[model samples]
Target chain A: ADLQQGRAKANACAVCHGQNGLASHPEAPNLAGQPIIYVTQQLKNYKTGRRTNEIMSVIAKPLSEQDIDDLALWYSSMQVEVKMAN
Target chain B: ADLQQGRAKANACAVCHGQNGLASHPEAPNLAGQPIIYVTQQLKNYKTGRRTNEIMSVIAKPLSEQDIDDLALWYSSMQVEVKMAN
Candidate 1:
């Protein structure tokens, strides 16, 4: 999948997982720099009902395998840093 | 439940969720400042098999209700910031 296409396709995901995949919500996991295998596996799990989250299930339900691959690749390619507060 | 006790019990969780509840692993959600209700509900779901996660289910299985409450409270009280990359 083209990285640019993946970035474009990830617009909806940016609502929760920031535009860069760093997670906008505390309840949402940061997807940037995640292992591609892990991200793909979870998406597949959500799609198959092996892992069920109300929102994730609905979001992943219609994603084609190619879409999943694109998303996984896009997210894994982004970078994130942990900023700790004192 | 004591907040201190919750912090102590959360040592195991810090492997994935940082000591302050910001996730260390991309697969883990940042728990800091999440709604207490959401955190508590998800833990219970994991414990009850309603949410099936290979790691979380096992970790949540033995927690008492009090433990869950403390964990929820502790995590909710923490603060985190989103750092975006350019």
Candidate 2:
């Protein structure tokens, strides 16, 4: 997983997913800090038709195994802190 | 899945999970608009120790089957809209 390459390739995802990985939109999921394997599996699911989303299908179509790993690593490495509400 | 009952019981979750179900905390997964069964299963997982989280374990401990269903319904009913990043 090459984070440098992942960061470079992630511009396309910035719009819906937010540059910080916290999605500004309600519909697009916030992907920051997900497990590496979870993010990787999800992208693969989109590519394999296991998960169906018009936008995701197109975005995931061309990624190679390495591409997915790099992207997953980049997203999962984002720092996310939780502040519990009382 | 009783929305009314679920809504009434959800005050405890609103702080971290957000009243809208898009978690305010990045560490908390969004629960709004998730499938009812998925939410139900997750709560059950917490109760059964299949998944472990400090706060969630305490929260899920006393819930009955009906309580879980009601809470799951409440969170899943939250409306979430997505805007694609371009």
The numbered model that scores best in DockQ is 1
Tell me the lDDT of candidate 2: 0.73
- Could you give the DockQ of candidate 1? 0.23
Q: Global lDDT of each model?
A: 0.76, 0.73
lDDT of 2 by residue, B20-84 (tens): 66566655666666556667876887899765667888999999999899997776565444432
Q: Cα deviation in Å at residue A23, candidate 1?
A: 5.3
Worst 10 residues of 2 chain B by lDDT: B77-86
Tens-place lDDT per residue, model 1, A1-86, is 66666777889899987776756776776566665677888899899988888799999999999899988888767654443323
Give candidate 1 misplaced runs (Cα > 4 Å).
A18-35, A83-86, B1-3, B16-38, B76-86
What's candidate 2's i-RMS value?
A: 8.5
- Residue range A39-67, candidate 2, lDDT tens digits: 78778878887666668899999999988
**TM-scores of all candidate predictions against the true structure:** 0.69, 0.55
Provide backbone clash counts, one per model: 0, 3
